[model samples]
Target: MSAVLAQAPAAEAVEDLAASLQEAGTVAAPPEDADAAIEEIGLREKESDQVIDKSDKKDPLYAISITSFEDPALELGELILKGLYEMKFSRPSKIQAASLPKIKMGRNLLAQAHNGTGKTCCFVLGMLRIVTPDTTPQALCICPTRELAKQIEEEVLKMGKYLILHKGIKVKCILRDERWERGERITEQIVIGTPGKIVSLLNMKVLDGGSIRMFVLDEADEMLNLGGLGDQSKRIRQRLRKDVQTLFFSATYTDAVKRLATQLSMDNPWSQIEVKREHIFNDQVAQYFYRTNGVTEKLERLTEILSVVNVGQCIIFVHLRDTVEQLANTLTANGHPVSPLHGRMEAGARDKVLVDFRNGTTRFLVTTNVLSRGIDVPAVTLVINYDMPVRKGGTADPDTYLHRVGRTGRFGRKGSALNMIHDEKEMVVLKQIEAYFDRQGLIKEIPPDTDGEEFEKILNVQ
Candidate 1:
């Protein structure tokens, strides 16, 4: 077992190196000379310039002003402006400021912004501008997760409540299980759903995409990672008219995601606006790691930590579905009010777990990676990683780790992420993650069986 264990890290290192080398080689290659390539392809400089100009305008992050909603005279309908005012949204977030003007113009957009920077509202407002009450599914928003889609739908309804009340414009959420019957027309002007459901509806001819003037992909990177890019998005695009507008939004811009955007938009100009690195992770989150000797010791330390910490709402992340269930059951049996959330649960059950956690009925949510992205439970004060994520099979990227921890410490609220690592291998991965963030001081060694007072002191719990 020791020999096998020693070989495992070596094998992983080799694989990591090979993947890095492949990526490096690709990046090191020279860009194709545009003039020669265009001439060979029988394209003119004028046409090429148009493409270049468009690309320059669209370069994913261009024209993004630091001032969000700075101009009081920005054009908006009376009802929309009223809604924004009512929602107390006096200022635009970075993403909303950058993307809204272009999106309102019905141009295709590819944007990358951090989570919780108000990317949803950017697309929602854009959708509202183009969609009229009489239109049938004029806009479609596809999110990677059902939770995110539901959340976006709820936000849209909230923002457009006055519109619905005054104008009778209906917005609907189409989940994976629910579908419009064949020959039954869509009455809603705006539709939001996961990719699978949207594709199914499109394939069944129940969704008429020719009428879809706008398409928005929220959390675009996750859509590609989940393997829905080729079939769902491509098929939906094929069904839409040539001039239909497209918007892609994501927190991180991985190479694969950039490639997908380029391919989908016919190499259209894109904007790549990135928030400053310092603003990526919430400074309010007091992140710390506790090193333990083994799983039993880790659990013991976790129980100790929980006993001392004044946790309002907490999420404990584990690697496997079974582990989530086991931990939840263990905590529940030990008098901790806990609920388990995983992909294996029925959608309704999973949603109930979220609702309970959000409503403060369940203080602790034991979950897998399913809840890592776009499940914003703001009241969650602590995120505890009970098991280190396995980076194999692309299951646990740095983005995933960040998202997991990001569950807490949201919206400028003080929070904490307590990582429980038990071995050298786990520590190595944690180091890699810290390096990714340039946060070397975040991890600290904990003595075995740390007392409540000592632990609190270490975590800086007031």
Candidate 2:
């Protein structure tokens, strides 16, 4: 390690870098236009034409499949193979085919794959194989949100059920519901949770890292960004052993995330698998936009769109907690069954709201960027960005916009994303998002409130 890094932890290193730059007055101002903003930040658009499709043999990655379930590469036992059969996962998806081998070899991974592509299964299998009964937390899987943490925990339990029942192994969810006694050890061989809870356990000595050998970060792009969860995750990793194997999985990437990956996986124990932006966003969803005057007109346009669009299950993403509640209440008063979700909601209430949305009891969910990544609601058909995301200093949030739209069009199903632009400023942000998606007419500009036959003919609105 460098002397500076050794003296200061990763979190402090970031702060120190910022402080030093600010002190020198070298922090450049951001570009006014979103396209220029992306370039100013050193992020260039991905050049490609083909889109992502797991079932398409024409997909270049389709050639990369595993031949033998009995291969020693994965070293799957008979019981695990039988369990896989029971789950009806006849073949590994694109990401799984490419990632499983590298993971089993213990190489650190930086993978970018959309949801419903079986990426979780790849890490789950690796965790199952790596975990041993040394009576300590041997594996740690950290996610961005409690909802995603629970989702991953559910998959881990399902895939590793045989081990859980036969070998007396355990997979624990480290959310608020899990209670711990003072001075007690977390003996689970595999652990999964959000960042703060995991860090708190380490601090309290309740979850020792001495036995942790494998660290998996789901939605790693989000976890490694400049945010609270990212900070906590870095501190948590700093506490682990040097040789610990790390795996990063996400649906997208930016220059910052790529730089972080190279820095963390610097020992040459690393492998990267990234798809072109076009290849990831094409064909799955039809993107469209409608311009509004501002927030006042936005409410009217949103109501018009909702009344027109045939929403099977929809998620409308905004940029604030107050907006979520406001929109949810407004739509509810108009007789729509909508639920609001944000970071501040209580744990039980959050779980209940998500459950209701997932089970189709509530057909609409209004939320913040909190629901942007690692959220898999396969039934959703419509995603409306009520407000495009911007960085703290008003730079474009293209990565987040991609995640917001990815909520739909899962598993090769055709879905749709509608971006709401208020003015020239937001139009700039939308352009950056468009360029990130390869700008070849993927997103269409639909006039606001075009109704009746025109709505059906153009947008297939309900």
Task: Give the TM-score (vs. native) of candidate 1.
Answer: 0.82
lDDT of 1 by residue, 352-374 (tens): 88888888898888988888887
Regions of candidate 2 where Cα sits further than 4 Å from its true position? 1-65, 68-70, 177-181, 266-268, 456-462
Q: Best-fitting candidate, measured by lDDT? A: 2
Which structure among the candidates has the greatest TM-score?
2
RMSD of 2: 13.0
Model 1 regions lying over 4 Å from their true place = 1-74, 226-230, 267-269, 276-279, 393-396, 442-449, 457-462
Q: Global lDDT for candidate 2?
A: 0.72
- Candidate 1 local lDDT, residue 427: 79
lDDT of each residue in 135-233, candidate 2, tens digit only: 778889999899998888877887787877777778988996677776988988899999988888898889998678778998898889887877888
Q: lDDT values of the candidates? A: 0.68, 0.72
TM-score, candidate 2, is: 0.83
